[model samples]
Target: MSSQSLEQRLLRAWYGKAAWLWLLRPLSALYCRVAARRRHAYLSGERDQWQPPVPLIVVGNITVGGTGKTPMVLWLIEFLRAQGYRVGVISRGYGAKPPHFPWMVSATDDPAVCGDEPSLLVRRCGVPLVIDPDRPAAARHLLASADVDLIISDDGLQHYALGRTVELVMLDHERGLGNARCLPEGPLREPAERLESVDLVVRNGAPGDSSNGFSMQLLPQTLINLATGERIAAVRWPGPRQVTAMAGIGNPQRFFRTLESLAFTFDTRIFPDHAHYDASILESLPGDRPVLMTEKDAVKCAGLAQVNWWYLSVEAHLSETFEAALLNLLSVPHSEKIEQE
Candidate 1:
């Protein structure tokens, strides 16, 4: 089966009580067992853990699909930077194969080589950013190269090799652990119980447990014309005009919902997570109507975009209590911040 079709089937099994979901339960159990064993290996020191000289914070999710990790990561980075701590970031660069183990990603780095999310994060982040399959190696490289006081690992909660000081797991409000099962049976990398171990659980919307950790709101910012780099208000595109929305992120439904909220109507074409788009494929879409995509997808579609292509940019707004709660939760003193060169 094609990757996109298979992903759809798995998503259905995860959210719905389908008969096929039951058949996948055994494999899910095996997946959990292996995951538990690996985690135990790291916790028990059976596997060597690389600790950074500075504090390393990880922003990730227990759920399998997109739970707004990217937005949260940017929020945390901004929060940390405002507090005067020199920060850096690292990502696994999924779907990208670089020439080396530790690849330093720059603002101008090719999205096709560094992966869409990593490239987007690097562009938004002024801090040192590195991408590698081995996250520990990337972290080590960042620490050695930059005089950063803290490090943030994007989307690697299951990667226990890089010793983390704090774990901030992001959860979607509506789909919080769909069916509450792991992997093939449901949409979780770790089980629901894993939330108990995380330092903080951030809800991306109002429909989640506020008492568990804290709530975060993703505020939709203006849309950027991918073809010409012009900013436009999201609401401006919604008269009787309809556009085609394209997203290749982990959760395309979230993008569609955002558009709906803005009073925009569009036909959706959701590709698999981190899927690339070529100019020819984009050319097939209606040229008369604008094409909207996520910032992640915009990175991959940079040179491939036509005049009507645009991408929505979002900013994560943390709850008032979350900022103070995070500071208290980590027990880090702002006085200890070292200004990096």
Candidate 2:
């Protein structure tokens, strides 16, 4: 068993203690002030810079962590590709074991360098991905290098300096807004009311009581095996076997509950979102048991994983109107901003 108990995990996740972690809101204000000034200068044309060739559609959320942004990003990439649009992606590459600067992510790139999600995107979508601390710089690099028609930011809702044409917000069904307050006070990034202005708001998991956004539900019972490329029925996995399920995602409870609903009796191991695991940890878990995990973790653990490890993949279900709204927004040509001589 890990040092942290299941109770502690719940406390950290939905207990709303982190909602109060924003006790440093004064400090957050200072950070935003500096950020806003830099962005204002750029938007006001006082800062002369070359804009990226194609339009950028930023899919991000205000609340920190676990709003289903990655799945939505992948969904958008697939949707746009099917529409005959060439897309590229840029990310801050959070949770990489070793730090990195703006660089391209290839199928061969290690997850420790490119981060788990970016690596997964490259492997699954086979599209160009840039990992960088400076997102604007990464976007510029993608524009100059890849022959992409559209650029989608994986998660950068607060990065106003990058200049985006469209914004998508994702809300968690279980924790819409803990206490409805800001950091150190609540779980909101800006405010719940901010959703009214975004281009699209996707309620991830189940539909909550929030207004001004589209409802989205994620069905998690689908099991995928990377080892044999075979799809196994999730219903058969539930039983008295000594099974251990591991997840290092924004929301592990969702995974646990989905498995439980399928009647799987197993012990659970939860890690921080994006926690890097070495071979030693995988070797230490009890039993020759079957281990279940998320797709994001599977990509990183592929080589280290044993034959019994399986990953549950989930897809976002959006109303047809949501897709139409997205295409309608893209259909409008980007209005060129006038530059002063």
Candidate 3:
């Protein structure tokens, strides 16, 4: 009926039916050509690079949204911290209201100001998270004050100007670069073949054995109270019930399926990636029902303190071999890393 409704319907249908959209590749290639020219000019010294003090590892996807980058970033942060590396995070602060310039995220900062994802990261992870359009600038600010050693961008695979050391590309096992095309043509930010060029490829969930890249499994559904930090055993919510589950995430159906698998029946409401939720939308849902959402949305729904909500936290389990390989890459001398790149 409307543009928003059309987008929602597409998302609901596209994940399982990628081949139908693959026909758009010719147009996607054309868009890539124009984008590549701009990228080449910038890389060839015709444009200035925004460099950060510390090495940056970009966790991103070719598709527009929901390849599980946030969980992957969370995994990396925890893994690096376990390895004794001081780390800070930076995000572009997508979908903030009254969009402000680079600012450090605090519990007090409105999600309307710093964005939902950045605010969630700051609150849940307890790491210094800065919101800025220029990721390099935000990374610099965090590095200068926090004494951090490395920077992990939430998503910046295409933001090549902010120089990075290693790039980890994430793919949704179910969606696998829908139509394998670029914006307006399909869903890819770059061609599917670009996966071969990245340092590492991560497929979230069981991508099925194809004798290909490494795989990371997402932990089963679990609930964490947004306010109390208390965990409710997932089994506590028995199904065939009318709970209200809201997801304003990159892919809402993935979350809906997750809730279903956990036996929590829902009247599902799917919002666009980074959708800003106001009072009215939250108020429209069944008020008496238990409300649930992805961790990303919980950050934005902070003001809905009156509503009972739990964040379904997903944990990433990267293989030991992948970890070892990544460590080896990181261990290489900077000179060697540059040479390898």
By descending lDDT, how would the candidates be arranged? 1, 3, 2
* Order by TM-score, highest first: 1, 3, 2
Best by TM-score: 1
**Candidates' C-alpha lDDT:** 0.81, 0.74, 0.76
Tens digits of per-residue lDDT for model 2, 1-341: 54354444543643455544456668656654555576567768887544556778888886765878888888889989999999999998886543446788888888988899999999989989998777889898887888898999988777766777677888776677655554434455665666765777787876542355777776664677657656776766543455788888877777788778777777888777777788876776655778888899888788886767888877777778888988887776656323211
Q: How close to the true structure is residue 83 of candidate 1, measured as C-alpha lDDT?
A: 90
Give per-residue lDDT, candidate 1, residue 18.
Answer: 65
Which pairs clash inside model 2?
20-184, 21-184, 22-183, 22-184, 23-184
Cα error of candidate 2 at position 265, Å:
2.2
Model 3, 1-341: lDDT tens digits are: 11245666665545545556666657767888877776677668787777675678888877776788888888888899999999899898886653455788887788888888778777768888887888778787787768789889989888877877788888888777665557556766776777877888888875442445668887755677766767866767443356778888777778888878886777877777778788877767665867788888888776674536677887888778889978887777656776766
Residue 266's lDDT within candidate 2 is 79
Query: Which run of 10 residues does model 1 get worst, by summed lDDT?
Result: 332-341
Q: lDDT (0-100) at residue 304 of candidate 3? A: 71
Predicted model with the maximum lDDT: 1
Task: Tell me the RMSD of model 1 versus the true structure.
Answer: 4.2
Candidate 2: minimum summed lDDT over ten consecutive residues — where?
A: 332-341
